[model samples]
Target: MQRKAPARGFEQAEFQARTQKAQALMAQQGLEGLLLMTEPDVRYFSGFHTLFWQSPTRPWFLFIPASGKPVAVIPEIGAALMRQTWIEDIRSWSAPAPQDDGISLLHELLAPLARRGARLGILKGHETSLRMPLGDWERLVRALPGLQLTDATGLIQGLRMVKSAAEIEKLAHICTIGSATFDQVPKQISQGMPLEEVFRAFRREALAQGADDTPYLVGGAGPGGYADVISPPSRRPLQAGDILMLDTGATWDGYFCDFDRNFAIETADDAARRAYDVLWRATEAGLAAAQPGNSCQDLFQAMQGVIAELDDQSGDIGRLGHGLGMQLTEQPSHADFDCTRLQEGMVLTLEPSLGYGDGLIMVHEENIVIRADGAELLTRRAPPELPVI
Candidate 1:
């Protein structure tokens, strides 16, 4: 007989905690149930990440009622994978060909609660099920015309904002893999190496170090080139005076770690060296603002203050940092305009960029988790100044 495959990294306690939090939110919103269909949210609540998402022919539906255990109404192809986890109750239908594949399954699972006058909470913005016709969802709503449907994305966003202990460990492991990969890039990026060669070398190193894939990888090299935010590496060979920006990250298991450092090829230029120091200070200022009870706006302001003090041209076109979770870039990005509060257990990236002159810009980014004391650095490596060649 063949042996069963081992379970993925899963913690029952974490699931229960999340469920309890959701239940509280449901009570506050007066929602009878929440209908989660987004891939990340589904995997988060159900602890199942199946490859069946590639088939747009069918959508996976997970119904988390205000009370009791959650039930997943998924395609038959994904049912087996769901069984591998602690989620025992699952209902599935065949496919597009079946008379009533996903539509029928969803109605059957929700009909009883709808009859009980249950209000359905949906993340309409991210719901892929509504893509085609939404005819099935409409029919189900009509079946129980009294049932109410409202947006419940806030409940999910709240739970995900606070990282659990297990999640932090996974994120830390991801950072370790990323840092290890970056540590080796110096040897490969010499004065004469092509930009593509540097890019390929980093990709290979990251994968070999256990990264499943990279979500972000864009960098460039030029004596005074930094015009575009993210462009493909060019065929031009890296020269001694080139200032290169390598901002990249890779996913390990499922968590993602992002870190970017500026490097000066072979010979260090005065402008590049000064830009690096300013960005380094700005990054540190941003990290310093990440503490319990602080506002995200304050964090960006801290970096903004440093950048403005250094160069009048410094401005934040993007968020100072964003919350990182299962799907890499999530929420809580520290925008100079946002008013969100900083809380403990939140993992964010402290990256502040400064653009000056034509094709001259500097950026330094790192990851950290908010703690009671202060910011806890996840990516422990020091920022690079010049290429090690």
Candidate 2:
């Protein structure tokens, strides 16, 4: 017989606390149970972690009742991993079955709640995408009639928005590692280095500095500024007077730190320098305004007040910044329309962007945790002036 694997990830108590909190929310919302199909939600409540989610072939499901441990309906391939979590009522089926990928099993598991006229919750709102196939979801809906499906996006968002002490520690560790790597760019980067090589070196530096993974890395380099923020790196070579920005969503123990730093290649023009200064000031304004009892709109306005020619468009980058924890981007986006109140223990990023010369823009970002009195910075502060590499 093979030796059993030890339980990993968060402690049993942490998962229990999470389940209890989610249960209370479910009860308040009149939800009989929550059916989680996304990776973050399932892992958040069950402490199950796996990189196999990269493949979109098989869909995993977790059933969270109003007041008890969650039931994991996953594939047999993940049985060992699921067993290592705090969950005991594990139900496995041979996945990638093509015809029936755990749909029948999920229907059987949720049948009891449906019989009680209890509404089941699923995430189907803003910033959320159904993780399972449409045919399977439709089949499950038909399998259990009168089982009203409600949106649990708000409930899950509320629980994940605030960070526990342990989660905060993991995020801080990753942020520090990313900051250290950013500090080395001035020496490692040159005017003629290709953007692709720079990206590779940044990832290497992040791993060397103890980052578990560098999953999100996007940036651009241009003479005055970059046009798009989310574009992949091209083979374009850096030139004098170019402004380069690298934003990373590096992880430590599955927690992420989302921020970026800007650098000038050899030299920066007056327009670029001024734009950098404005962006830096905007970030400071956001940091000052991020505290308990404040609204996300308030933080957005505060940052927008300082920047010159601030554009609030829903383009490549939706909002100035958004809630960060457990995933690269969470909820309560810092946009003018969002009124979500900032509460203590919430981790967020203060990202402010402004247009520079014609069609070029510069952006600055920082990460912080909301506190009772004020905001506590997690990543090391960027220099007041953009460094010339």
Question: Candidate 1's residue-wise lDDT over 297-382, tens digit each?
Answer: 99988988888755645434577778887766777767867777888899888878777655466667788988898899988646
* Residue-by-residue lDDT tens digits, candidate 2, 1-389: 12222223678999999989998888888998999988898899988888999999999999998888999999999989999889999988898997889988988898887787779999989878889889888888888886889999899988999988878877777888888889888878898999999999999988888888999999999997788888899999999988999999998778889999999998989888888888888898999999899999999989888874554332225578998988999898998899999999999999988775678877888999998998999899999998888
Indicate the residue-level lDDT of 173 in model 1. 82
**TM-score for predicted model 2 compared with the true structure:** 0.96
Task: Please tell me which predicted candidate would have the highest lDDT against the true structure.
Answer: 2
Error of 2 at 245 (Å): 0.7
Model 2 clashing residue pairs (backbone): none
Off by over 4 Å in 1: 1-8, 51-55, 97-101, 124-144, 310-315, 384-388
